[model samples]
Target: MQRAVIPLKGELTVGDDYTAGDFFDSVSFRGVQLASDDNMLPDSLKGFAPVVRGIAKSNAQITIKQNGYTIYQTYVSPGAFEISDIYSTSSSGDLLVEIKEADGSVNSYSVPFSSVPLLQRQGRIKYAVTLAKYRTNSNEQQESKFAQATLQWGGPWGTTWYGGGQYAEYYRAAMFGLGFNLGDFGAISFDVTQAKSTLADQSEHKGQSYRFLYAKTLNQLGTNFQLMGYRYSTSGFYTLSDTMYKHMDGYEFNDGDDEDTPMWSRYYNLFYTKRGKLQVNISQQLSEYGSFYLSGSQQTYWHTDQQDRLLQFGYNTQIKDLSLGISWNYSKSRGQPDADQVFALNFSLPLNLLLSRSNDSYTSKKNYAWMTSNTSIDNEGHTTQNLGLTETLLDDGNLSYSVQQGYNSEGKTANGSASMDYKGVFADARVGYNYSDNGSQQQLNYALSGSLVAHSQGITLGQSLGETNVLIAAPGAENTRVANSTGLKTDWRGYTVVPYATSYRENRIALDAASLKRNVDLENAVVNVVPTKGALVLAEFNAHAGARVLMKTSKQGISLRFGAIATLDGVQTNSGIIDDDGSLYMAGLPAKGTITVRWGEAPDQICHISYELTEQQINSAITRMDAICR
Candidate 1:
C-alpha cells in the first residue's frame, strides 16, 4: 500500500485521506523513497496502495496489482488509510511494480528492487589449517633439526589430523588422530603415536616409545557413557626396565631436569563414566599403588599423586532426595615420595534430620585415609572425618547457611566453619585448632578463613501496551486504540492522536494516552530508538485466552508457544530480556533453538492466539513443529 503524509500538528493525524485515485504519488508526499530492508515493509502496505513517494500526498489515489491484475484499488483522502498490508505470492518470478501520482501521472522518482531470496542452508565448508616448526642448535653433537605438518577438516564425519617429527639420522616417527561423530548416536575418537631409532643396534637400537588412546560416548542407551582407554609405554624393550619415564597421570606431568632418573614408568588405564542427575565413574590403572624390588634391594616409594601402582575405581549415584559417592585410588610410587600408599573413603547423606527446617541439600560426609606420606620414613596414617549441612532460607532468598566440621589423626585434630550468601552480599568465617601426637616431635596445627563477595544482576526497563490486539478508546486516535476514563474507541478522529511518548529515561518506553500513532493491523509496533546494527526482542500478547505464551525474539525472529503451557503444567512466567528491535538480522535462532513460551498464570489465558512474529522466528519454530526439513 502506498501512503502520503498529512502534517497537521496539534490536530492529531490518524489515517491517510482516501481521495486520490492513486495509491502512491510523487507529489504532496515529501521526503519519501524506497524503504530499506530495515523498514520491513508490512503486507498491508504492498497491496492496492499507490507508491506514495516522498513528494506525493499519502491521501493520493493508488492501485495494488497481482500478476498484472488489480487486487485492490482505492482513493485515499484525509480520512483513514492502511499504509501496508500482508503480502503473499504463490507464483515464482520477478515482481514488477510501479508508483504514480494521484493524477495518474508516472513517478520516475521511486524504483522497486528485483531479487530472488534463497533458503538457508547448512553444511557449508569453512575451515583453516596452521602448521609451523623450528629447531635451534644447543649441544650441536647430532646437528638437531625438526619438521612437522598438520591439516584439520570435516563436518558430519568429524575431523582428523596427525603430525610427526624426525632427526636427520633417519629416526622416523608417526602419530595418528581420528575423531568420528555419529550425531545423536554418540562419538568416538582415537589417538596413537610411536617413535623408534632409525639405526638398529646389534641387540636393539634406541628405545621405542608407544602410546594409544581411545574414547567413545554411548548416547543411544540414554546413559551418555564416556568410555576411555589409554596405554603408554616407552621401553627399549631390550631389558626388564631400561629407560621408561612419563608423567604418571594426566595431572600435568613435570620431569623438571635430565638429572632426574626415571627407571621406568609404563601404565594402562580404562575410564568409564556417565553423567546425569547422578554422576558415575569407574577407572583402573594397571600399575597404580604397586611396589617393585630392584636386585632384591628393596626401596619403598609412594606416588605424590597416584603415579604409582595404577588401578582406580570410582562411582557416584543420586536417588530421590539423597546423593552419595565412593572412589578408590591406588598407585605405588616405585621410589618417589609414595603418595599412592594410602586408601580413602567418603559418604554423603542429608543432614537435615539433625537440623531444623533445613533444605534438602543437608549433607554429612566422613573420609578415612590409611597410607604413607612423601617425607615420612615410617608408615603413617592420615584420615579426614567431616560433618556438614547446607540449606536455603525459605522466605529470605538472601539467606543461606552451611557448616563444616572435620577431625583426623595424622592431620589437624579440630576444624569448623560456616558461611552464607545473601542477595549480592557474601560473607564467610572459619577457624581451626589442632592437637597432634607425633612420633618424633610435637607439631602445632591451626587454620583460618575469611571471605567477602558482592555483585548485582543487571537490570533493563522496557514495556509495551495493548499491541493492536485490542482497540483502545482514547480521544484523538489514528490506526490504534485509546484508553482514557471515557471508554475504548477505534478509528477516532476530530481528537488528538500522536505517538505515545516522544522520549524515555533509563531505556523505558510507555504509550501514554497521547504519545503514539499506529495503523490497522499494526501490532507490537515498536519504535527502537537505539539504532544498533541488530538486536533481540521479546513481545507478549496476553489475555484470558490460551497459554501464557512467551516469545523469545528479535526484529528478525520470534518464538511462540504451541504446547508450552500445557507441557509446563499450565503455569508460566513471562520474564527475561530481548535485544532491541531492528537489530536482530538473523534468519533463525542460534543453536540453542528459538525463543520459548508457555501458558500464563490465569486460567482463561491458555488458548491459541496469533501474534506479530519476527522473520527470524518463522525459520526456527518450524524446525521443531515441522520436522520434515530438519
Candidate 2:
C-alpha cells in the first residue's frame, strides 16, 4: 500500500528525490488512514469479507454503500459479476449496491454483510474519522470531497451502541445501531440508516434502510453460524456514489448506432429496484464421520418478478490414510431463464499405504507421494474426470511436483498437465504446463517471487516479505540455516531477513545450531521481538569465528593446577579453566597464539605459553596440542 502524507492544518512540502513503482495495489492520502478501521492489521486477521454479486444488463457503473458510506464504486461490462474485494466499513452493516447502465437506467440491490460476534468489553470505546476526496476505480466519473466518522461504545447490560455518518456536497447520511451479547443465546445487532441525495438533474431522493445480523457457535453440537443476516431498503434510496453520477452523460442507442454493438447493449434501459436480501452461512461437525457446511444468499427486487440466488454445500471426511469430499454449487442471475448447477467429488490416498515395508528407501520416497482423483458434472450434464499424483522431493521438502491426466466427456478429449514448485532460500518459483489432445493445444507459465531488504549494514535477499519482518545479523556466520524456516539461511555476509513476522506479537527467531560450522560459535542462538505494523526490526547475534582448541600445558615442567585460569593474549573470548589433567579447552582461537596461565597472584604462580597449530589441526573440529609455559 502507498499513501501520500497531507497535513491537515499546515503547509505540505515534498523533497526533490521521489520514486515510484507498480508494486502496490492502491494509493491514498495519509490522512485517510481512519477510513479503514483495521488498517494496522493484515487482511488475514480481518476475518471474512462480504462478496457482492450482481447481473448487469449492460455496460454499467456499480456503487457499493455500507452504513450510509460509499465504500466501493467501479465500472463493469454486462454479465454476471462478483465484487469480492470490497473493504468493509464495519462488522455488521449490510451493503447496498446500485448499477447505473449506459442508457441511463438503474438497478439497485442489497447484499447481507456480517462477521463474528460484535461484542466489546465493558467501558471500551473505538472510533475513527476521515476527511478526503472521494476515490473510485472509474476514470469517467467525477470526484467529490467527503467526511466520514464512526463511534462504538460498550454499554451496560451486555449491550453496545454504535453510530456513524457520511457527508458530501450533495449527499448526507447517518446510521445508528445496538448490539447485544446474549451470553449463551448468541450475539445479534440491529441498525438503521437514513440517506438523502440531490442528483445533478435537480431531483432529491430520501430513503431508509434497516439491517439485522447474528452470529452463534454451539460447541457441544458442533455447529457454527459464522454469519446470518437480512436487510431491506426503500425504493427512493440513493447513495453518495449514485447521486454524484446519476444524471451524468450516458450511451444512447438508435437505428444508426454502430452495427458492432454487443447483444447485451440493447437492454441497457431496463431497471430493477431492490427490496430485501437474506444471507446464511453455517457449518457442522459430524464427530468421526466428518464435517459439512452450507452457505447461500438470495435477493428480491421491487417492481420485478425475478430474483437472484446463489447457494453452495460441501462435506469432507477422512478414513485412515484416505480423504474424501463432495460439493455442489447453484446460481441464477436475475434476467436469466436457466440456472447453473454443478456437483463434484474428490478423493486422495497416500501411495505409501499400499507399498510393502521391505524396501525402506522406496517406501520412504512413496511416503511423500499421494494419488488423487476428482470428478465433476456441470449444469449441461458435461462430465470431467482427473487423476493426479503429487509428491514432495528433497530432504527438506522444499521441492514438490504434480502430474495429472484428465478426460472431458463433452468433447471426448484427453488432457494432461504437469507442475513444479520450488521454495528456495532466496525465493519461491513455480512452473506449469498443460496440453489437450483435442486441438493439440499447449500452454506454459512460470512465476518467481521474493523480497529484498536494504539496511545500513548491507543488502540481503529473502523469501516473500509479509506485513512485518526481522533482519538477522550474525557476522561471519555464513550459510548458517535458520531454525523453523523452509530453505532459509544466512548469506556470505552473515546477514538474512526473516519475512512474515507477526505484528503486535512476540516472534521468536532462532538459528539452527546443528547447521553451524565448527569454527563459528553463537553467543546467543535465539532472539525475540515484538514489531509494529510494517516494521523491519533488527535481531543481532554475536558470532565468534576461529579455531577450537583443547591443549595440555605445563608451567616450568609442572602441570598447571586445576581451577587455574587460561586466556589467549589477543583473543577476547578465548578463555578457559584448566581441568584436573591440566588440559585447557578454548574456542575462537587463532592458529598461533600466546596463552597466559594464572593459579594465584604470586609472582612465580603465573606463566606464558606459546602455541602453533598445523593446518590440519586448525581445520579439525577440536585441535589438540601440547605446550610448555616458560
Candidate 3:
C-alpha cells in the first residue's frame, strides 16, 4: 500500500487577523472541501462515479469507443487496469474496449454504461472532514480549535441532498440543502442554516438563515439562466466565525478602541448587520451574431439605513476572425454619496498581416493584436477614458503581453504586462510581470503561481493539476514520449505526470512508437483515463528486454530439416523451421549461449551449436549469425 498528502492550489491564506488586526500567512484545505478524484480517500468520502477496467495479455494498445465514437485511447502493460472519471453522455450506450498486442493479436470487450432520469446509476456520495487550529495574522494569543464535516449524496428521482456541521470553541452551526432537476426547465435548490453561540458574560444566542437558488436553460429561446438566488437572515444571526470573534476577550472592531485608525476603516466594513440579499445571472446566445449576459446583486442591512447594489451586462461576438465585446457596469455602496457607472468596448484581430506571403504562408492562424477602450461618467459628472492593447501567442495560448495608456481624473499613465504558462513533466507553472508609469512615478509588480503534488511515489512540483491528474510508471522505459502533451517525456525513473485532466471526461495518453528501444517490447501503445474531480490516478505499463536474433543453419553441409526443434541450453524456445532460403528465426537468447537442434526424439539425432558475442553486440537487437550442426 502507498500513501501521499497533497496540498491544493490557490487555497492559501494571506489576510489581516480580525483579533489583533495584523498581517498573517497560512494555508487552507478548502480545495479538498469537494469530492476527490482518487480512491485514496476514505470509503465514506469516495465519489460514486462510473469507471472502466480490464486486463491485457501483454503490453497492448487500449481503445474505448462509445456509440461508435472513439472516446479514449491509451497504452497499458500486461495487468489488471481500471479507468475512472470519464465524462460521458447520460444516455444508454455500450462502451467498446479494444486491446492490440505487440505481436499483432487483437482482443476486445464491452462495458455497459447507461443513465436514467429517475435513478442515479452513476451518482456518487462524497464527504470531507477537517480538524485544525485556526491561526491569526497577529501573535496576540488568539487560537481556536475547529472541525467541519460534510456529506453529499445523489439519489434517484433526480434528487441530491447535502448536509454538514461545524464547531469552533463556543460557536456551532449546522447546514442542510436539497437540489433536484426540473427536466427541460432546469434545476432548483433550497438551503437552511442554524447557529448557536455562548459567551462567558452574555446570554446564549441562536439564529437561522434561509436561502433559495434557481437555474434553467431555455433551448427553444436560446437563453440560459445561470444562477438566481435569494437569502434572508434575522438580526441575531451570526456565522460560526462571527460568534467566535464576538466572545473572544480583548477583541475590538477597531484597534485600541479608536474609531480613526487608518487601516481599521477597511476592516470595519466587513462587520455589518444581517438582513437579506438577492443575486441573478443570465445569458443569451444569438448563433453567429453574438451573445449577451446580465448579472446583478443587491444586499440590505438591518442596522444601516443604506443598501448596496451592483449591476452589469455584456455582449460578445466574432466576425471573420475579429472578435468584439462591449459591457456596462453600475455600482452603489451602502452609504456612499454617489453611484458609479462605466462602459467598455474591446476588439481582437489576427496579426497575420505582419507575415509576408510566401510558398509556405498559411491563412487561418490565432496570434492576435487586441485593442480595448472604456469611458465612464458618474452622477457627479466626472468623466474618464482609457485605452489598451494586447498580444497573444498562438499554439496553446502559452504567452500573452499587454500595454495600456489611460487618461483618468487623476492624470495620464502607461502600463505594460506579460504572462506565461508552461506544463512540464514534473509540474505546471505560471509567471507574470507588470510595470506602470504615472507621470514621473513608476511601479513594478510581478507574481508567480504553481501547484505541488505528493503521492505514493514521492513529491512532485508543477503547475495546477486542475480537477484531475495522472502519474505514469514504466520502470526502465526512460525518455519515452507522452503524446498529446507538448515536450513531455518520461524521466529517469520512467515517471511522467499529466497535470491537467478533465473531471468525468475521457483523456487519451499514448506512447511515441519511434522512441522505443529496439531490444525492448512494450505490452501496449495507448491508454485512457476518466478521473473524478480532484483525483490523482496512476497508469502503469510493462516492458521486457532480451536478446533477439535470426540465423542460417545447415546439417552436414545440407539444409536443416523442415520439422527440426531448437532449444536454448536444453530449454525449448521460440523456433521456426528453415525457409526455402535455408534461414531460421529465433528469440529469447542469452549472450554467448549454446543451442541444440533435434529432428527426432533419439539422443543421437541431437546436435549442439555454440555462439559467442562481444559485450557491445550482446545488447543489440535482431542480430543475424550463422552456425553449422554436425
lDDT of 2 by residue, 84-175 (tens): 87743344444657777433455555555556545555776555555666544333334677666667678999998888787889888888
Of 1 and 2, the candidate ranking higher by lDDT: 2
Question: How well does candidate 2 match the true structure in TM-score terms?
Answer: 0.77
Per-residue lDDT over 1-630 for candidate 3, one digit per residue giving the tens place of the 0 to 100 score: 111233421121223111100000011222222222234444333222235554433334788764334567876433334477564322223355666743344545444332212111127654445565554332223456666666656777888786777777777878887777778867777778888766444557677778676778898878977667777887666654444343333323322334333221122232365578787767899999999877676778766777666666778899987777776656665545566554555555655555425412333433455565544444455444445556655443445665544443433444333445554555545564444344344434444555566677776554545547887776656777776665467777677777777654676877775686665555666778876556687777664445666778887888777768777775443344666666776654567778778888887788877887665665776778788876
Determine the C-alpha RMSD for candidate 3 after optimal superposition of all C-alphas: 15.8
- Steric clashes per prediction: 100, 0, 23
Task: Please give me the total number of clashing residue pairs in predicted model 1.
Answer: 100
Q: Candidate 2 has which clashing residue pairs, if any?
A: none
Each prediction's RMSD over C-alphas, in Å, is 31.9, 8.4, 15.8
| Candidate 3 stretches greater than 4 Å from native | 1-180, 198-204, 247-265, 268-272, 335-340, 352-410, 418-433, 438-469, 473-480, 492-495, 501-507, 514-523, 529-538, 541-630
lDDT of 2 at 237: 63
- Residues 1-630 of candidate 1 have per-residue lDDT tens digits of 232221210111122211111111111111112211211223322212212111111123455433223344544321112234423221221122223422233321111211111101133221111121211121111222332222223434354333333322334445455455545544444444445443222222343323222333444323323332333334321111111212112121123324233222212111110010111222322232321111000111122223223333434454543443343333333333543323333344653454533533433312111211111111355454445555554332324555544444443444434454332211222332222222222223332322211112122211122111111222223323233311122233212111222111112222233334321112232223421112222222121111122333321133322333212112232222223321111221222333322346665433332243434544332321211100
Per-candidate local distance difference test: 0.27, 0.69, 0.56
Q: How does each model score on TM-score?
A: 0.31, 0.77, 0.59
> Candidate order by TM-score, highest to lowest?
2, 3, 1
